[model samples]
Target: MAAPLDLDQLQTFVMICDTGSFTRAADEVHRTQSAVSMQMRRLEERIGKSLFEKDGRSNRLTEEGERLLSYARRLLHLNRETLAAFDDRSLEGQIRIGTPDDYADRFLPEIMARFARSNPRVELTVICEPTPGLVEHIKRGNLDLALVTHNDARQSEVVRREPLLWVTSANHATHEREILPMAFGRPNCVWRRSACDVLDRMHRDYRVLFTSFSATVIAAAVLSGLALSVLPECALRPGMRVLGESDGFGLLPDCKIGIMRGHTANSEIVEALARHIAESLDNISVPSAEEAPAFDLAALSAMRGRRHKPANLMPGW
Candidate 1:
């Protein structure tokens, strides 16, 4: 019979795919680049197929490597789950976690549900604040974990990424205005500042019509047809339509979501929670830019002419 696949090797493989570089995967796996290369060589030999091919200076997965990736994740996840079932270090007591309100609304449900299933004895305490506040809480050891927008140079493990898109209410032609109306977060918010800077570079006519720290308030403004906002794909809702280059709004940077653990936190439980968060976010992506339809402003303008309408403005912080 064929020998069982090595979990460590598979894990290294997955990390390479996740990080898109051998050097990064080496750092993540705590192995030297040479050692990581050796592991992949052995893995490829065992599978009897070349797993990666050179694309310029970088490694691109071969068809065989892509096929192994899903299986590798499943195997590693199952391995973790099996060990957790018998581990005496199962989580108990209270775990304090923090996240921005926007993330708490969009991402907490999955993270919480997965966590609750594995550590039912643990009581979870959640705090909703902006990323800066959450970072402070984690740094002070007041929070055991924090989900944050990964922009600043900080100690964080980025777990998920998706496109940041321009958004406006589907029912309104508000985005068609001569001077674009916008809703944004607090003054210090990164997304708000970045979006404004990008608009300025494009020489777009826009006004920050509303400013609120609350994502709910900002979303309310957007839905009311008063303004346009920038948001990650996951936070999109039914009444919202994505705007693109066709709308004169240029592409924004990818939104990166990460987990930060407290400086002094429960090692076992915190690590477990982090793994669940990462796994839940894995292998997901927003549709490619090539797939976005060319939007027509004239249609929205025509629809606006028929509206006896009220006005409004909007989040990722």
Candidate 2:
């Protein structure tokens, strides 16, 4: 077996990678530059390979260094979790969670509120971002757990998926001419791609009238009829309603929701938090078109009809 590596040295290496400079890493780790250098030297000797490439002014990780970075991050996270568990098995510790913008905006607040009522002593910190970014943060050990869409072939390994629905304004004019416009998320977003694929396969002509990275912005746009977009049932709002049957639109493939753990070694509090989050999400209601406001496509067309506006049309026209 390979010799056991020093956890402190690995921590130093991780700090260096995160901060990208020894001077900064030393400041963060509360060690002098020379002492930090000594730790690295000793670590390198133990590993029998240079972890970083130092040219006059710039510092970069060697290939071995890059490989070690991933392992070191996981190790440090495990170490922290281990210490936290020994300190307290009761769910009264800080839990840092990362969620997608839409999930954070619509569903997380209520679920977290319930959790807070039950565990008043536990501190919760939530970070919101796109699924890809959240996944990266979890992998980097920056978050104890994250809710995100899965990517790649390892898709089913760490993901739970739910059906999505298309929604639009309840009022519309031309049943045949209603060119559905929509506001969507950034390119890397799963919902955006799924919605577009379904429309294309159905031979439905639609246009993306606007795009925004924020979930709130997309919801606002949909309400204003700036465009129609597909979202999960949990996100349906007062003015927003489902457009079809739950399965009317075939399963939008499976947009995976990843539940990642920072470390499994000794993170009882965090594990409890993860379990709560997963259970809460799984229990959320999935509404169908019949359960939602009924749309009168033909009546909607007559109510406030949509007409094709040419590019050169006058501002008020």
Candidate 3:
């Protein structure tokens, strides 16, 4: 009987495909480049097909390799789940987690739900705050783990870089205004700082009409046609429209979301929760420039013409 494929070999293969180079994969797997190459050779020999082909200086996955990628991911995921299920199920401890309101709203629900099922004995305490506050909590050893937005990638294990968007109410002509009115969260918020810095650098005339710690309040302010706000693309709502160059607005800088561990030593439970958060976030797809929708000034103008009266410009706060 033919021998079954080794999980280690499959792991190496997947890493190579993901990293797009044997050298990088070797670094990730803690193996020498030659060792990684030998593993790939043995894997191809067992499968009776070449998994990769040389495309110029880079190696591209073959059709067979492409087919195996999906299976490899599923098999690896299942393997991890099985191992975790058999691990010390009795392990119990408290894990304190911190995150910005935006990320907490988008990702924490599913992450916490899955974690609750897997680690029923583990107690979780989550704190929602701005990125700066979360970072402070982590530094003060008040939090076991934190998810935050930072300009520096070296600050933590970066989960992803999310594009910032200039969002306004779809029903309002706020984008066409000469001096833009904007809403932001707290003064120390990353989004608020980025928005103000970009506007200042661009020499744009803008006014901060509202400041609130609650994302709901900020969203309500935007939806009420009182102001435009800069937000991570994922935080944008269906009723909001993204402004682009055509809308005569300067582009906002992207923000990197990272995972930070508290200064206090992490227990096994804390480490496990951090791993889960990282994996969950890594699985999310960041929108490409081509996929992002641009602002339609013509449409906004057309809608404005049909409006019988101007929108209320008062701050929601």
Best by TM-score: 3
Which parts of model 1 are misplaced by more than 4 Å?
A: 1-59, 284-317
Candidate 3 positional error at 288, Å: 12
Model 1, residue 3: distance off in Å is 12
lDDT of 3 by residue, 292-312 (tens): 344444533433343323221
Clashes in predicted model 2: 8
TM-score on alpha carbons, each prediction: 0.72, 0.55, 0.76
Question: Model 3: which residue pairs collide?
Answer: none
Candidate order, TM-score descending:
3, 1, 2
Question: How accurate locally, in lDDT, is each candidate?
Answer: 0.77, 0.66, 0.75
Q: Tell me the tens digit of each residue's lDDT in model 1 across 1-317.
A: 88999999999988887776788888999999899999999999999999887655455777788789878987887787677667788777778889888777767887787678677777889999988888889878899999988986878888877666678988898889999999988788778888988899999999999998778888898889999998766666667777876667776777788999986647777887888888867734333334434333343333234332221000000
* Residue 51 in model 2: lDDT: 78
Query: Which RMSD does model 2 reach against the true structure?
Result: 18.2
Location of the lowest summed lDDT over 10 successive residues in candidate 1: 308-317
lDDT score, candidate 2: 0.66
Q: Report RMSD (Å) for each prediction in the order shown.
A: 9.9, 18.2, 10.8
Clashes of each: 5, 8, 0
| lDDT digits (tens) for residues 168-189 of candidate 2 | 6555421134576778888777
